[model samples]
Target: MTSRNRSTRVSILSALIGATLAVPAAFAGQVDTAGIQSDGSYARLVVKYRDSARLRTAAADRVAETIAGAAARAGIAGGVARGGAALPLSASRLRATASQADVVRLSRALDANQTQALLRQIAADPSVEFVQVDRRLTHTRLPDVRPMLVPNDNYYQQYQWHLHDAIGGIGAESAWETSTGEGVVVAVLDTGITAHPDMDANMLEGYDFITDAFVSRRDSDERVPGAADLGDWNPVANECYAGSPVTDSSWHGTHTAGTVAELTDNATGMAGVAHDAKVLPVRVLGRCGGYTSDIADAIVWASGGEVDGVPTNASPAEVINMSLGGGGACDTLTQDAINGAVSRGTVVVVAAGNQGQDAANHSPASCANVINVGATGITGIKAYYSNYGNLVDLSAPGGGVTDGNPDGYVWQAINSGATVPEDPTYGGMAGTSMAAPHVAGIVALIQSAVEVPKTPAEIEAILKESARAFASAPSQPMGAGIVDAPAALALALDGGGEEPCEPGEPGCEEEPPIDSTPITSGQVVTGLSGVAGTEGLYRIEVPAGMRNLNVLTYGGTGDVSVYVSRGSEPGADEHDWASTRPGTNETVRVANPEAGVYYVKVVGESLYARVNLQARYN
Candidate 1:
């Protein structure tokens, strides 16, 4: 594929306007306060009202009255205040969330504590469904100095080890021979993008979803066309937050976009994972960080959903990469967006955050129906700053700059600008933010490699089933393993299983029966046996709200280990929970297991027979 000039392509973005957004199903409970700060700093609230004729067509005044009513009922007092000045808590309808909930917003920024209290009040109202603070999420990159070798790309051999290095790479070089992600579109939702000659040819028209004029750095609050990198440089002290570090523009989106779809074999820059694919650069982040509301809209629009004011996407993305996140569980707004995208067949991949904590506490990363990615160093160990835990679905090379390996950073195209757009150059950055695009690009490769596009579920299964085991044991659970592009593509192309051999092919034989046997709760299976280095895979469908899930193996002669994981197959070393006793008897229990398909792998440490396995949850 040849590169094309941007000036010659028709723009796909148009004027952004306010409209009702589609929301997800009713999430009953106290509003999500996971990311809400209690520091008393100023912030706004995202409120979703029960669908009523009044709310669907309510005016701004009516919405305000609803807020007042909720506050009064909660026994709160006093008007909202900002900067020590009394301000009217105005309301504005954004759009219906995917749940069909009427999403409204409080315009006046109130004290964080006050806002949280108000959110609870709003959530308690009979007419209100859910409410939460529209927390800001930043790009998850850790700054580092940045080359690579491969496919005649100048930097591939020197700097892009994350693509082909057997120890840590995604096997992209070999996968490229099978698929270059041709005809696939990957939407990059981040700080927009910069003009880089190396990636310019593969760029698609994208939109800016930022609504705040202050954050968008525009004169008007209205969303505009074109998702250009406007430089989110924090020029003033504490502009983002009190004592927030002053830093230059990250050009984060450009780097990620380059990783996803930069032109390959151009003989000038580093190779991209899916160079034949196109990038739809949706700008959601800006100065300081972007709001959850804006990012959610980007997710919806990029996946070909309707967003009020923005034109329908000319080229809906098959994969969406969000290398941004912040503290919090999955918020309703973001989850609804992701749910819609997944239902539309878009594979959503997100960063596991750079907080070095459980990703379960992070929004988007913790969101269901999305592939959560953690970062790995050059040695294929979990990055020290990458978030971990059960929610992380997989790990990828995100570089280990802070781990003292300067050359281990993921390198890609970036701008030389400090405050605005500058000359295009290459650099390295570390974090799970860098890890996500690698997976996203692999998704594109798999999507393009097969004759039929795999569903989001199928894609996820292929990635996990084909992933290479981590080179070393991680300090924390880093997911199934590192994504292997060639393996994944091959799996997809082989009809999601072993490719059928030709009748006359040499060494061809009948395939063995699949080992995936369904096990129900409180059921015990007898006569389970396996030889050393062999394993039996079983699954249990744990319905929602299952507590005390217990899987026990006993009455067996051999030494067997039990490995359990949710939603995907588990390996001896990669599972959510494990029990390896000296004998065949082993037990793994969970206090409150999330409702999903739990996979159990019974591996034989030594050869023996006559085993009984029981999985029961109350």
Candidate 2:
């Protein structure tokens, strides 16, 4: 994929009136004494009343009361309380006033021992659901350097360049065939983006759902009302702290957004796969790990806002990209919200996770409604750190841990200044996080090339059928196979065309009995000793009401595979199903098998070995 370069320029537009408002910093006298650090700067307090039945009516009141009582006892100056569903109780950031005593007294009063007592006292209240120290945020670091790209390497190029080649390149000659991702608005739910050269022209309207302060600025900016800044909220900076500190890691969000829809062919930094598609930036993560409740709100808002406080999202996104995950089971509330997004015609795409375990243990990605994407190396093999499972829908190049080749992975960085580099600049990184955007880009390309809008089910079907299966991939690791852009686009454009089988159809006919043996339930169908391979070929007939059909091989050393089609003569290399493995018994299930006599071919695994077959339905 060739990279594009555009001149860098920065534009500071007039701020919208209501867009620049600052949140009030009044502490309702709540002092969160649980898990206060020795430094007296940070404390871990479990949020109170996260899911109270009367939360809608008295949430603010309950939070205010808790803060007031804690402040009075601890002699804390003031503090801030934020709502979070993931925690059972409200957490506060408190400061000890001068009258309260010196730093030593404050520390002694709110130390671990005191904190435990405070928790016990708070638990006596029936309204308080639970309380515990807020856990500190942690992250696994990625190597900080650009990976080297091999010479003339086409495979490692950016997604857009490959897409351009698939559509016959950049001039008017290819105008009619050019792909534009219509009806596909991708939601970049991450840290806020910096107005970089490549992204300034492509980004759509987005909001900071993280800091309630509503000020849009960089991380280093002082805590002033109505000030815009970049970076995560730092709770230690202010007494009534509601945010975390910003760090270099915060740039991840901007970089990811650029890869999905950076302005293309404009001689800019780099071309994104679907340059014309809109991006909905939903800020969720900040300095420390964001609260689950905030991330949940971002999801709902990105999907068109089913919850209150979030204004009704104007342009409901068609795709949501969550590059973050936590160690936990799929939560009911979170999963329900994802399902709600899908029901509203949105396709949620999530990282398979960087944990290198089966994704079933994680939330959202493991959730049934979204598409879980795993990471692949430049050589088209699975990335060492990528998680895998039957739940994984597909795989894409996510740049290897130590094998950066062909310009590494050069994507736009979030919060990068106006002077960001242009050309095929490389930055090496590995994780399922990088793999997801590739799939999102492919989905955009497929949508752009096809006329009819495909449902999530149809899109998934097309992707699975067009995937390039590999024998070297681990059984549960790589999924159906690596993603093929050209193949996927071709399938999308074909409207997933169908073929038929039966008497009168092109390659249809009746078949003679095999090996002079009569068919029986327990007997395995063996080699073609009696029947002619060409003249005696017959298709298995499927009846109605059957949702699934399976073709099995009882015993064989040769390859055995199944194909389902409406057409008797299948198109070149377009079999509905194909497998190359030999086993004592192998079963291939066909979903919603159609009512037709579909050809089931059994080929030899090795030229000299014989294969046997059997069929079952459910």
Candidate 3:
């Protein structure tokens, strides 16, 4: 893929599936305009006005009064957070959309299709800038993946193939050398993270944004601090509806959060991409998935915006990762929230989706300025279940089932029990849901390495500019090729200054073929492993009579070994041995050689390359 930008439109999809985030679970098949918990005829609307001035002054009340009057005239009776006509439950339907603004999100049971007419009334009002109704979102899990697999305390070498994937992994190994994502915060708007032993060190106090009492498993209808995953399990007995069925809890947020900032090199569980990054678990999803209103509020609050009724967020996140999405055009509410976040310098990353269809139809991912991530299999091709289309910003190891091996799925922390949140354990689950966090983790890493810290736009530029080219282009366009951590980090560590390149421009710095291309001494070059049996050859012009020489290889996964040979192509007979036990890193050192020229051959035990190679002569 080239660096040339491709056609893009602002859009978003729904979230929640596979224990991931978003999508009110019970609504997976319920597309009617009913509120997530209401019997029917319930809709949430986001209304904004043209006059930004009147919003912050005494006129704010006047603008709101005008809106309330218009709604009443249009047969709408709900007040802010339900302060309108009757039923305290109305409070659940009304709330200020933003602080110091007439922008308001109001919910009410309108006559069938009457919500659009109400929006039209609101839009016709002289003070209104725009209006949008919330759409229904649902979550669905697919068949499990299978793979042949490892165990590491800080390493989980075999299981975390996605981190070290030679072709599609995010390239975490080398990235850690430059930045461990020490100071950045990633706010995960999902079911909230579990209290996993592997993630406690990097976890921060968060909030519960699920406002629906039934969906939140709460006795009251209020949101609270301390976001915790109580398991989004729907009982077959049907309290949510007449026929809502029971399903297994995905513990999806646990998996997503674990991937983003799970404790790394801690001698337990699996390694997170951004080891030192802190995760702010925002509970936007629960029992049946989550309400769009709650999700939208979380997005705004995470980026440091004020959502009335919720406490002011003191720990605003630099990066926001939403793995859940729904199908539809970008809603004004969600879009506005994302816009506000990006404007505030927060990098938002979302999954393209697992529907295996064009991603143009998904929210959040379709939304503007978001990094929509698609899933790649162990083979580096698009994952079978991943959604595609021009909307995707990039691809990452979402993990795919290979030969019925479950290990093909990206593995992370999960609950031990089936229906309830329980003991911490680990498992592999596949979806575009599993792919978004990889890039979010890297965003934290990039934020950590830069001096002044990059704006979301600049961070995205570095990510696209330094990404490795795909071994094989996906059937449909995937964003700027797969994400390459080490390469991206190197550019970031150099105080990145690359602009956002046009998508799919060939022969650019981002898509160079370096594995087989030889380079001179000391300069670091980026390259990929491609397929099995392919090797990168590097020639270093050794100065005559050099006392010592060292060849080192770090980053990528699989078993890649390095061999150095002088006076001939490096092979079994002429090379000095420097094999180190059985790990991903390789190095070969030579002493006191009469130097002419030396060649380094990188051999993969199982088709790996995407490595950072360096040769030093003294």
TM-score of each: 0.80, 0.61, 0.67
lDDT of 3 by residue, 353-383 (tens): 8888888777767777788888887778878
Please give the distance, in angstroms, between residue 4's alpha carbon in candidate 1 and its true position after superposition: 47
Best-matching candidate per TM-score: 1
Q: How many residue pairs clash per model?
A: 25, 44, 52
What would you estimate as the lDDT of candidate 1? 0.78
- lDDT: which is higher, 2 or 3? 3
| TM-score ranking, high to low | 1, 3, 2
Off by over 4 Å in 2: 1-177, 211-229, 232-247, 401-410, 414-428, 469-475, 497-550, 553-618
Rate residue 45 of model 3 by lDDT.
Answer: 51
In candidate 2, where is summed lDDT lowest over 10 consecutive residues?
1-10
Put down candidate 1 lDDT per residue, 200-308, tens digits, no spaces: 9899879999888788887877888889989888878877777887788888999999889888887888889999999999999999889888888889999999887
